[model samples]
Target: MAIPDGLDRIELTGLRGFGHHGVFDHERRDGQEFGVDVVLGLDLTAAGTTDDLAETVHYGELADSIHGVLVGPPVDLIETLALRMVDLCLTDARVQWASVTVHKPNAPITPTFTDVAVTIERSRR
Candidate 1:
């Protein structure tokens, strides 16, 4: 997807983790793998000009933070997980907005689907 409007984006895709997040008791008990995608919006001017990591969002740190949220808690919905990820992205003052998608590839559903996911976007105010 294209970056929205005037903001520069830093994207992380296919971040995998195992978590106990589901409505079913068996799901929470056994846990399952989850994939996260995050798009962070901000101005890259300073970083681009100076070529300094401090002037931009450090993606390695961001990935670790996202993983922390993924493996940290047990929420019943991917929507909630997406919100948590958005919150993490917004922790950086430079990040003006964030879009998050939480993918549940192995969700317990009949008929067998490729994936199930929830997406959320939040902007700093």
Candidate 2:
């Protein structure tokens, strides 16, 4: 992973939530709350110096994109969904490395728990 200079982090959370996506049929049908936490590594020197969105990743746009994919279709797995979210964020100009964590709060697990989640990290090629 080639990390841009001085770009340590850009964290995005809340992102509303996703109601669908999972491997089981019931999971897809029932729909659940998916929490996403993202850490974006990039070169923020330019954006910081210039104070411009063009030089950095636009979090609002990224959130919108993630929300779209989460609710759009019947994805089979959270790994796949997380990977796609990583891909979605990397489509931008400023992102050099990205780490995505998606949490399914209302998972249909037999035992009640805080939440079920999958986390993935990827760097730009």
Candidate 3:
């Protein structure tokens, strides 16, 4: 199938996660397991035709880095965490656009729930 001249796709989902970040004190202190899914859109004209790894985005490395950020130093806000994740994607050379979702399953709320999540998308101008 022929994609557009300036668009490629990479999707990663069900990546196991951990984080101690939230507005509540318990959430910050106790930490929680989260899930992340991301889809990166960028130019793959050269890589797709040439079959070169260097010319494409390294999805494995990107996932690992995002995993690191989620489990790293405790932050107080999911918004900040989301932004940090976006920043990481923007640093990659091949990723011209991306969509990110962070899911919190063990959130410290009074009521029982399945999960809480946030999603954001960005692209170079």
Better structure of 1 and 2 per TM-score:
1
CA shift of 16, model 1, Å = 0.2
lDDT of 2 by residue, 49-82 (tens): 9998788888888888888877778787788888
What is candidate 1's lDDT per residue for 1-125, written digit by digit as tens? 44568898899999999999999999899999999999988999999999999999999999999999898879999999999889888889999989999999999998869999999998874
Clashing pairs in 3: none
**Backbone steric clashes in candidate 1, count:** 0
Indicate whether candidate 1 or candidate 3 has the larger TM-score. Answer: 1
**Candidates sorted by lDDT, descending order?**
1, 3, 2
TM-scores for every predicted model: 0.94, 0.86, 0.86
**Using TM-score as the measure, which candidate wins?**
1
Residue 74: error of model 3 in Å? Answer: 1.1
Better of 1 and 2 by lDDT: 1
Q: Runs in model 3 with CA error above 4 Å?
A: 1-6
For residues 51-72, what per-residue lDDT tens digits would candidate 3 score against the true structure?
Answer: 9989888888988998998899
- Which regions of candidate 2 are displaced past 4 Å? 1-6
| CA shift of 72, model 2, Å | 1.4
Tell me how far the alpha carbon of residue 96 in candidate 3 is from the true structure, in angstroms, after superposition.
1.5
